[model samples]
Target: MIRIATPDDVPVIHTLIRELAEYEKALEEARATPEQLHEALFGENPAAYAHIAQDDATGEPVGFSVWFLNFSTWRGVHGIYLEDLYVRPSARGGGHGRALLTELARICVDRGYQRLEWSVLNWNRPAIGFYESLGARPQDEWTVYRLTDEALESLGKRG
Candidate 1:
């Protein structure tokens, strides 16, 4: 059962985020708090949205996918940028991940989004294969760039 997450799901969501970070070997950088999650997803101007997969019989959340909208200048259409997609190890191979991804793709098609994009760690071969199986290819011509906390602060002071 995949559905939009509500405020009440924060605790479980927080746990899942931490679990995912640990899986990615970045547990030390996982500083998300309940308050931060709430503000990002449910504040006056929500920045993103989340979908949770729950056990059909037990009603316990097993995984989640969170995303935000992005605009492609070339295509002139808004698309979904998937930020996080995680399934508990026990839930893997159960089709939950595929189902969640299928739903997100459906949303893109229905809404006429130009593209759906995300990044996988270079070492995560399993994820790369899964994405390839779904016909998502890596954009070899482009490199992802980011400004960390300190860099962002410095940019502001450079003026």
Candidate 2:
């Protein structure tokens, strides 16, 4: 069962985030505090949203998706940018990942959005194949970039 996250789920979500980071070999980068996550997901003016996937029989959360809306100038419609998606190792092969993605695709279709997209690490063959099996083709022509920490602050000072 998948449901929108609530304030009470922040700790679980935070745990999942750390678990994912560890899986990706970047646990040090998973720095969001549970309090920060709570604010981001359930704050007064939240721009982020999350969905929790539960074990149907046990009602225990096993995975989650964190996303936010981004506007495409060409499409002129808001599309969901899936920031993170994680399923616990113990819950692998239970269809939790697909369920989470399908829910997002449903939301996009229902809302008339033109696209549903997210990035996958090039080295994650399992994930790449999973996405391909779902008929998702990679946009190989594009490259992703980011500015954080000092560079971000430096630019902010410029602005």
- After superposition, candidate 2 runs with Cα above 4 Å error: none
Q: What is the alpha-carbon lDDT for the whole of candidate 1? A: 0.92
Backbone clashes (count) for model 2: 0
Candidate 1 residue lDDT tens string, 78-152: 999999999999888887888889989999999999788998999999889989999999998999999879998
TM-score on alpha carbons, each prediction: 0.97, 0.96
Error of 1 at 136 (Å): 0.8
